[model samples]
Target: MSAFHVKVKWGKEMYPDIELDTGEPPMVFKAQLFALTGVQPHRQKIMLRGATIKDETWDGIKMKDGVTILMMGSKEEDVPVEPTEKTSFIEDMTEAERNTMLQLPVGIKNLGNTCYLNAVIQCLKTVPELHSAIKEYKPKQPESSSLLTLAVDSASLLTLAIQDCYKTMNSGKTAVPLILVNLFRTTFPKFAEQGEQGKFLQQDASECWTELMRLLMQEITAKDPEKTAQNFRTSLIDQFFSGEFSCEWKCVESEEEEVTKSTDNFQQLLCHISQDVKYLHTGLVARIQEQITKKSAILDRDAVYTKKSKISRLPAYLTVEMVRFFYKEKEAVNAKILKDVKFPIVLDIFELCTEELQKRLLPNREKYKDMEEREIEEERALKRGKPGDVIKKPKTRSMPFSFEDDLGSNNSGFYQLQAVLTHQGRSSSSGHYVSWIRLKGKEWLKCDDDEVTSVTEEEILKLSGGGDWHCAYILLYGPRILEVVEEGEETEVETKIGEET
Candidate 1:
């Protein structure tokens, strides 16, 4: 039924070599083999030629025209024992295999000997507990990313050691590529099953490579070979976020404010707020990391930890909070100390988190769903309107609409904010500002910039449609922040902050 390569000796061990037959081409190797053979293998394992193999049946093929070959008894005791508990060098293995196989070169995150991972890697072989720690960090899911960390900070040192005894076809002058190639070869097949990420991988690989190269290039050219890579990383980050990604600011306690405070209540508030915010941020990051661990499409290139010591100044060029205090009597409410992820990346970690959340939340949106048929026509009209092209006013906006609070959980203290019908063609302007907000809580809760200045009707009208308007700013604060004060002519509770982009 099928072809076979047989080394037959009566009463001797059955040594085997396999060759495909039944006229099966490599691509059709599996399916054709099944059709030819009346007997099929019990289990399937992938072979190098994209063929699936099962337990071989000598009966399925002719071993020298049905000559009965006797085999020696199974050598159960001679079976190889798998090593556990530790890695050991055996004389049987070659040198290159030991270095290239055991020592992962590329994409291994070399945490500055400054971090805890270094200690873990150093003691992994020696200590069982340390080995377990390493195991814990490995990705449990196929879709998730494994943490790219090194046991030592100086992978280059490790590289040099390997270089002295063994040579690898190392290029790019960095050990990263070698490491990445091994990783890619190992993991790419697992992911290629779904076939969704091929395009993204192709696109991201070049950009990421260029980014790394550009960073290294600067340091080499400046005669500061030492600082080149690190500086390049920093510069890449700066460039990416220059004008991309709309970010909204949330206030955290400033360091100067933290150190100056002698009050116990003040300290407690900071600790509590910090704890809450930290919990939220940590949960978000964990979800992202978990995804990276599971998906191969996502590279856990790096986990960015914001430097906690420094203060955060909002991006330059966008002057949002020029006039600090909003809401007249409200005390300090600002994000003084800034801590956030440093790296700008589109990792699978983020993607998996997004997918799971969307499933649970039912937030799937088809592309361009928000565009109306009329809106599409309008866009077409606009595109055609070049120089000397007459523009047409949009169709009538006389449709009626109303707003209702999503009272799903009233206890959430969150309101269901929506838009309502405004008066017909009223010349008066109404505005909703979302660019930024000043914390408008009591002396205990507010972060520095709390007082809001009152503006006239004309000033408000001009920028009501400034593109960033959202529902309304919601506040949950103690009653102390609700004091009424008569200022100027009007006694309005001015809680808005100066506009920021």
Candidate 2:
């Protein structure tokens, strides 16, 4: 590795032998990798059509007007480059690499771009037969210009195409034994920029795209399709998501900040259609469908998942906000024996909490066996207590807010403070139950880190609007809950805003 190098500041300043394999050299490597997108000029080849020099000889390292010059490959070929904009490169998955990185496993993403790229490359590298078959084909196009963007679009294309092929394979149809980019090149050449310029005076390659697809399926994909797809998929994941690479979550909120906000657009599930994208029809369709679901707004909205709205499927933009909502309710509901309760258990402890709620309402026999004992218990508690004054706050069903009270009670390990506040979240239809107890900053901080997901900083700000929402009612037998109930005699339960806490 005796390659000397010079690190020249592109815009501001300049420098003159730089280490090749290290330092600024890495930038060169990275730039080249980035350029690998559309310009698929073989790994070791160079194809610079138009340049200012009489020849391609630019000495040592030179920086002229925001351009960095480096001797590339066999001859010192100077290439102009720039760091890809962060926004352009790392698309904020709310919106929006190359080989040397692959050393591990990937997940079953509907469309993991990295997986697609790795899989397609592996599929191609492992099976040379696939290449020979593809070499016989070329892209056909009504117009040209599309050819120019091939390199830039390769990543998206490869992933999308592989996904397509996977979908087709899933449909019980045979798929390519190797990567299908060639098939994409052959079948959708118009899209791939391979335009029908046959090796020997192209004679309109193949008019029927379908026929090309048929030939591809018959010859390549159909060969041990499943293994090919699986192997390709496995190899891909193993290569990309290796080690040391992980995401860290820091609450966009700072300790000093009073409020936080986050905007959660659901576009993460989108798979941009790429010109080079090639995959089995079955897999492709399945992926697109799955993606449609993953980013679906209906799902993200945490709306009372109606079967009808879900029929069309939700888009990615709205899906981000649907964090925890899915599994949270199930976990909460499963926390206790929710059904087939002893009505007697209900009646035994009924008056201890609130007598009004236990009244004529359905006992949910399936939910409770008896209710009288609980009613009597409540009657006794009320008897010990004075005639409670019920504050009448007319129920406002329109707003997404509610206030409820629960009385005092106790047990062994920790007294049975049983007031569980159940209220519908602004975005949810079903009521969510949170212990009305007020949590400290530490707890909120923990929630900030764990409970929150997908919602963006911008969105959170709007919802929270600088308030800690740091309050609720959680006492098992606080004076609040007992205020509405009377003696063993029945009484009315009313809600009032001015009522004292």
Candidate 3:
């Protein structure tokens, strides 16, 4: 008899490489599971080979090594309630004990309406690459740069200050980086200026995002250019957060056209408005949909030019800024658009791509469509099945072609939303900025200054701006990579069964 290793998953927990003897009876396996998961042997259902394992020899079922098994049973145990003779009230607890029980996360103090900066800090923490880069960062050629010079140079101070804060966050201690705050004030003097009672005036979240991204690009080091091209992979921000556009300008009078290419090297996608703003994807598609009239190119004659734009490159991460704030000359302030523009958890941009790019993305799109159909079929069968019946799962295959350098590129022009920066108020200069960050599955976190709390997917969907509540101002979308199970990795059991992790 030989022993085999397999993983057993119960809920979110997984136990990998659990050894089992093939010579042992099914009851013996249940006993082992009972010890590991605290599930009664009789109540536990060991599923393998498309049927529940019974009290038969392991050889009778022909279990294989390196296979996964699903063990389903209630982990909760009921405890009988008893009458309490004595109870402690809140007033009875010691001060130290109460402090331990009510521990709070370290938060940045708002230096007079600095919520914009605070919100930005909390959101950027979600980027793992940024965290790692800041941790490994070193101030190169310090002798070449003086503190006075660094203070004047926004890039230098911003880099040092950001790295300092990141280091503090990494230390697992809750502390604020006052140095960073001062550096930010120095960089943007307008923000440092007092508005009311020594408080700073509200700043735009989009501006904060832009400035931070610019500083990060200047401070963060990129990998060797030659190696990146050779491997078809680039740095995280450049690989995913950047986009390229090809532009053509034609003069109406001369009937002459000039073609030029421009790149959004700074990781920001501008949202173009249409007649009625309903969905985010629609507005984005409209941005590159057609040609628009521009200022006259000729000085002597009244001649106009038509400018056409098209996307040439798609990054791993997409940043879309809703053009909600426009300068009002009469009001002398940026006006806000309260229009409710619905967005999606999963956004497809195939309609916004160039013809050749769309052709390249079709293969992955088809694969995803087929997978969706298979999943639906499985779900339908599951709905019709009786209780305790094992429902089979559909297997997924990989796409044929994808970018070599970037694993998370939108092979099929599909994106999953990762973060949203929202504003709640009438004007950009007066609204309260908050950061909503995705926290695994349908759960999200709302970071409003020092306060952080869990939120639902429904709440996130409602952020599409209608009233005074927080409206989505900036949206960050990440590529949804297609999952391809290897041939031998997933095979139907001769008798038809399932695998779980």
Candidate 4:
């Protein structure tokens, strides 16, 4: 049998030059690991890209030479042969105390002012597509960055660190992303260099989000020989987050028919502060209809330009940055707009679209409305002690002009709130960032550095910013897909794509 070398890491130690035959069962590889780490094959759980490799042949897993795989689970722990019987009493604890004792929260460990990174990571975790992308990543070549001072390559370290964290989270374990933090700080000298009293300072959450997203995009394309590493500017961010605006420019002496038509792209939807604007939908709609005038290129006189943007292609996850910070010339600081602009759990952007795009969206909107009405009727019937008929939602089909081939395509203009990154201080430079993520309906988790606690839907509504407390700075909304059900299937069925990856 032909054997190839691979690297295996168990805890802090890496065992290199481990050879295994490609045709052999995974148990054969585990047997060798057993000799090195004193861990039995049954107890060992081998993982690749945040997924557990099954106890099958290497061929089944597409294992290649020099592949780095994560090995979890420990050697057998010593347990007592005899058990000590103890008596329990009702007075042992109060109901609240017992519930508190039963709770075990999963969270990250804070490394200085790394709460911003933590908050962003927790928020991004809510995206199932991103999770799938990270799991499907396979390194094509060895990282060869000599600038890295760490024992391992900077890129590989960051990738493995994040993949390991994802794997741990999937296994329901809490861990600190220590390796990623170290490499991130090292790669960006500004992040590591900037601080007060010789300590790392708090960083902006959006900046962190952008940097991490860039790295992830690069990793996604690294395995393909045809494609090179891509930055966020050229990757899915542009494909999905981008919106197109049609600009009609007319000269001062020009007629209506002689106007020039151009297109502009925007990555974020700005929520302009206005007196009557209370909801997110209203602010976005207002921004899309504004007109302005500027000096024409050929004609040195002023020209009227009317610009209106409509999303031509919708990404699975839409990121909306609340434009709350503005530079103050007199004070030499960034001022915050603490307007309580209330956002919705379900946001509809159909009205903001062009006439043509609106026509394309109406079909899906109608289907979604019908699904909602049926669900509501079912709920009412259940409340009235009447058996309701099981209805199957229509399966999603492909669209020609969609954003990308990736998952998370928003067929309709409807979106549901997935995550929110909030800031607590007055200035952008100095503020605490926390992540409020929607786990499911009416259930949210508040991730504040090393602490994570449950919050109500009411608490999320209050994050719109009216006080000195944490306010929603960045909102991430994902497509609200119609729930897929089957006839005679009374139980709710979760239709998850790319679960294997």
lDDT of 3 by residue, 440-484 (tens): 767787767655567899999999987888889888887765655
lDDT (0-100) at residue 321 of candidate 1?
11
Candidate 4 lDDT for residue 421:
92
Task: Write down the lDDT that model 3 would get.
Answer: 0.66
In model 2, what is the error at residue 125, expressed in angstroms? 11
TM-score per model over all chains: 0.15, 0.16, 0.67, 0.68
Residues 128-166 of candidate 2 have per-residue lDDT tens digits of: 233343433222221545333222233333333444344
Report lDDT per candidate. Answer: 0.22, 0.24, 0.66, 0.66
Provide the clashing-pair count of each candidate structure.
Answer: 30, 88, 4, 1
Put down candidate 4 lDDT per residue, 1-501, tens digits, no spaces.
366777788889787666656554465466456545656455789987777877654444656678888898787554557656565444795443332354533556687788888888888778765666666644444364431212233454465556656655564456566555765776666677554578887777877877877676555542222232122235444444445555555454555436666766655667876778788888888886567787766666777666555555455578888877888989877778888989998888777766776776777677676668766865564455423433333343323223233223456788889899999998776778899988676678787865677799899989998789888988998777665335555554332322210
Q: Is candidate 2 or candidate 3 better by lDDT?
A: 3
Pairs with backbone N, CA or C atoms under 3 Å apart (clashes), candidate 4: 316-408
Off by over 4 Å in 1: 1-91, 94-274, 277-501
lDDT of 1 by residue, 1-501 (tens): 554443322133222332334333222222212222211111113232232333223223333322322222221224567856566565654543443454422112221211111111121112222122222221112232221111111222222222211111222111212222222222233312222543312111112222322322222122222332222223222211111121122113222222111111000001112223333223223322211112112233332222211111111111111111122234322212222111111111112122323342222122113324545654576565554555443323221110111111011111111111011111111121111111221001111111112223233222212123221111111101011122343432221122110
Give the candidate order by descending TM-score: 4, 3, 2, 1
**433, model 4: CA deviation in Å?**
1.0
RMSD of each: 29.5, 27.9, 21.6, 11.6
Give lDDT: candidate 4, residue 368: 73
